[model samples]
Target: MTDTKQEADFLIHPENTFLYIWQLFMVALVLFSAISLPLYAVFAKDIPVLLIIIVFLFFCDIFINLRVAVKTKNGFCWETAEILKSYRKGFFIPDMIAALPWWLPVALLFKNEEPGIITRFLFLLPLIKILKIGHYLQVFEKSLTINPTIIRLIKFIVLVGIIAHWLASGWVLIGPVKEGLPADDFSKYIRALYWCITTIATVGYGDISPDLSQNHQIIYTMFSMILGVGIYGYVIGNVASLLANIDVAKANFMRRMEEINSFIKNKKIPLEIAQKILDYYNYLWETQQGGNDSQVMNELPQSLSIEVSMYLNKTIIQKVPFFTKMNEVFIREIIMQLEPLIFLPQDYIVRRGEFGDCMFFLSAGSVDVKGSNGELYATLGEGAFFGEMSLIRGEKRNAYIMAREYCDVYRLTKESFDELRRKYPDFDQQVIETVAERDAMNKKKTEKPAAPVKKQ
Candidate 1:
């Protein structure tokens, strides 16, 4: 059983380059254990060098597992006792099973007689080590946090293809040793692979058929037919599922884009307007995958949607002192009422003397605050807000705000603010105080010094 704390806690150390290097080494060792070890055993001779290489890899496997367990245990913030318990339950049993083959070779060194059935069976023990690949996959899933989709695809291929390759290669290596098995072109691996592919595809070309007389050969042929069908079904189904999931949304988005292009060409819309439309659509597609955020939010329960809204706008709302003073629940309610607005370069968001009924929070890009005569007063970027004073006081806008570039803002209507004020008396008091301070500042800016007139 996993500790409750360990299950909830995941330490993501992306800055640790050494950890990444270690993970890569683990992947290499897993591949060697799962794929290479079996291949080596197939053609292994009594060479001392081959023995040394096999033994070295076997020790490396043990060492890597130990190091990984220590790192993982530390990452989980495990105490000494907990680490010991986890090591016993998680690592010890599986590591022992994987380590079983390492001793088999050492035991065989004392044998003076010719190699027998026992020797061949000893070579087969490494197949048990392939179980470690599952553990490695779990580690990789937890440790690595970059390019997740590509990494997942690579894992899937390694998990499936390596196992299949091992089984096929093992069959080819073992088939010739059996009695009464005809050894022709069928013994060649290239020929065997061709046969396997044909069989798996259910397209037996009659070029390679098993001898029916020998029981072992018949059994082997039956196994191949069954295994081939299974492999084909599994591969085809997964590939189809992956394609269905990955491309359906993308294909629809492309079709919609093409339609927009055709419409623009036919209508001959102004270049500026067309480009703005394209930019808006591109931003929507990139950020939300061409889906409506409001529509998606409507599908969820109000409580859940509000929570999600709170999470999404947390940073922006925190930057605005107005929202920060309100309790989190009221803040969430305010966020839920906010709607997204986009502006292109040079677009006037609000002109001085225009009636103001909405405030804006800049989520992205920048805007220039200009005086009545179009003199630049100030510039505001992401996390800045404007127009709230006019909206609160039911007055005209104080300044002209123009988009310096393409901008994304969250608009909060006066209706929503009024509704909030009516619900929360304390929040209403705060808003009134804020409006007073803002009005005083504006008055100060507009007031002229009487002393200058006396000096003239």
Candidate 2:
């Protein structure tokens, strides 16, 4: 198995075991709670207290479940919200179930950080409100994923909510309809909410009014105007941002598709091979786009022309250490024969025992040169050449070369070397000189002895 696969398997095994234990514990808790609820109702004879305890326990269970869900990597906010809703319904169980708004619990859980005890308790109300809002947002996000059209619908809802709150608060202070209002009835709350919505939307019909006795018209008027402007701006800003993100995503997708098409056309790849290239291209594109692509072989296509051109340019630049002193035409010819090779991290570029048929010019990244002494002799980076000894002498590689990271190399094979040598007679002399200098350096390093120890 690949290293990634092994690591994934290791991570998953523990998670699965933990999930199983968690489920078992939850089942036990639920069964115990179910048994205790009725027993307490019958024996204790204090139904309200028993009911309160049961309700509190149910909420506690929900809190625990939500905590677990959020901690898990695959946690879905919607799922956690649903659990909270279910717990609330169960706790209230009978007539006119008095469940708090969903946002209350969510906001509490997602607070900025730990605060002073009193501050934390004070913030709890807002936190719960925000959590309920987040739950709706989570649902909206999921809806967008399934049907993007829902994004517009969600935006409209937010605008309506903002407008409603603004108008209701404003109308209660300024409008005539608010005068001589009954304080106790449900109609009072409905009218207040309605007026707030209208004022916030900036569609004041002048029907509602505040009592002249209150003399707080200016405060309500200022509050509504400010809130109206903020809400309107927020809605517009969010809508604009969402649209921009969608446009960017579409543009990127088109760009990748165009790249794939260009690759297929330029390479003249067969349909089957082209399909694989397209798949791989998509994989790399998604990786670049930040998504999963394991189910599809998202390997990027090797554009022969582009790869060859890049190899020529990089090889010529890298070979400057050797070729700057040589004829320009000869350097160009040598570069033309070189091919680009990609190696993943830790891949052996040149195994010690393998018969080396090519010399590699590093275009990018680093490689470790493992010597016979079982230690890394040196690390070679871009512009460095390796496996050249075998190319000059027609022998096996003297050292192993392992990639330190994903690398791109320009390789000149033995056949290409021989052809170049036959074409350019002077090349042999340069190769011999380069090899001799490297050998002399190696010999000196080996010959150098440890210094005599001073008597202590």
Candidate 3:
């Protein structure tokens, strides 16, 4: 079962299995129609089975569109009237033109009749569906969890195929090749496709030269040349652009590392230190995509930032007994104040005998809580936190906190905790009482050494 929140995000009800299947079917069907419909018009006279299927699906989509949930600022609006209104105001006309009976009813009435201008014009009506397909594809993209780049790449490939097919169809209409037009439709299409491939790619092998004597052929060849240049440039540019954007985070991280490497080499840094620096950055890129979470959050609106922070910290925050009981608003406040920290392997997060001024929550990797001489006390994995005792007692850290691996942790400073604790009497009182108890114990231990010696 799909979660309501996720469904809300997509503005659809997953509970309607029929509707879900229909939507998936339509997205694919529409794509097929977008490519096949135009090509079929150029080559074949009789209606293809695909045209019939598309026409049927198009009408069915209109019916389905009216009942599907509509998303608004509040949430998914399930009201039929609203959905209808939305459909009407949006792609209703394009969809209507695309789905109409067009030449189908007439073709059925006269099976052997040649398609006239009327039939051709009607056949072209469904081409408008191509416009609405993009709109539907946007929704489709949102529904799928896959990377948008993959979808963009798919779209690009489909576009190139469509453009190539269209060019081939146009070539067939002109019969521009020196060998003249083939008698058979299949042969005509294949030869046209071959010519288009060579010409569009600017690889016009001598076998398929255009007839320059014929004015139309000459004009067509010149147009194709100009068109080829645009397409050739576009294909290269688009491919480069797509590759650049495919993994922007990784690219940026790699570029930064290059800069760091150049600097290190220029400065003649020690190999060991340079290697450690490289490892730290590589680990950072691996774990956090080389981004500072707080800085990224800062760019977001306050409400959205808080929501993201809450989501990130929810698991760790819930693990804390005190925090679990905190009010939602206070929890969000605490979450916002936390700064993400990452410690390299064997890095001291907490030095023994160092005064602790902050608390730590291990969000990823493990840390070793050890004694002064590297005697490991325990290992803390993801969601385990430390420094609450320091927060309560206002004392030095008793144990060394070292990251066993590259650890991602979130730190909440004492100042922020102090301010927050004061707002809640229970929290403030608990800290005050715990500190007082520690102070009293320390005083007793100091004074009791002579008494212990006398007893011995």
Give me the candidate number with maximum lDDT: 3
lDDT of 2 by residue, 260-324 (tens): 79988998889977876566545444444633332222244434543445444644444544455
Off by over 4 Å in 2: 1-321, 372-374, 440-456
10 residues in a row with least lDDT, candidate 2? 94-103
Tens-place lDDT digits, model 1, residues 161-246 = 66456656655665534356556433555555666667666788976666666677568667877977886787787766654555
List where candidate 1 sits over 4 angstroms from the true fold: 1-31, 44-110, 122-156, 175-249, 259-275, 289-312, 318-333, 371-375, 451-456
lDDT of 1 at 77: 30
Clashing pairs in 1: none
Off by over 4 Å in 3: 1-23, 38-45, 68-89, 105-121, 143-151, 170-185, 206-223, 321-325, 430-456
Candidate 3 matches the true fold with a TM-score of 0.79
Highest-scoring model, TM-score: 3
Candidate 2 lDDT (Cα, 0 to 1) = 0.57
- Residue 247 in candidate 1, Cα distance off native in Å: 5.1
Q: Rank the candidates by TM-score, best first.
A: 3, 1, 2
Clashes of each: 0, 33, 0
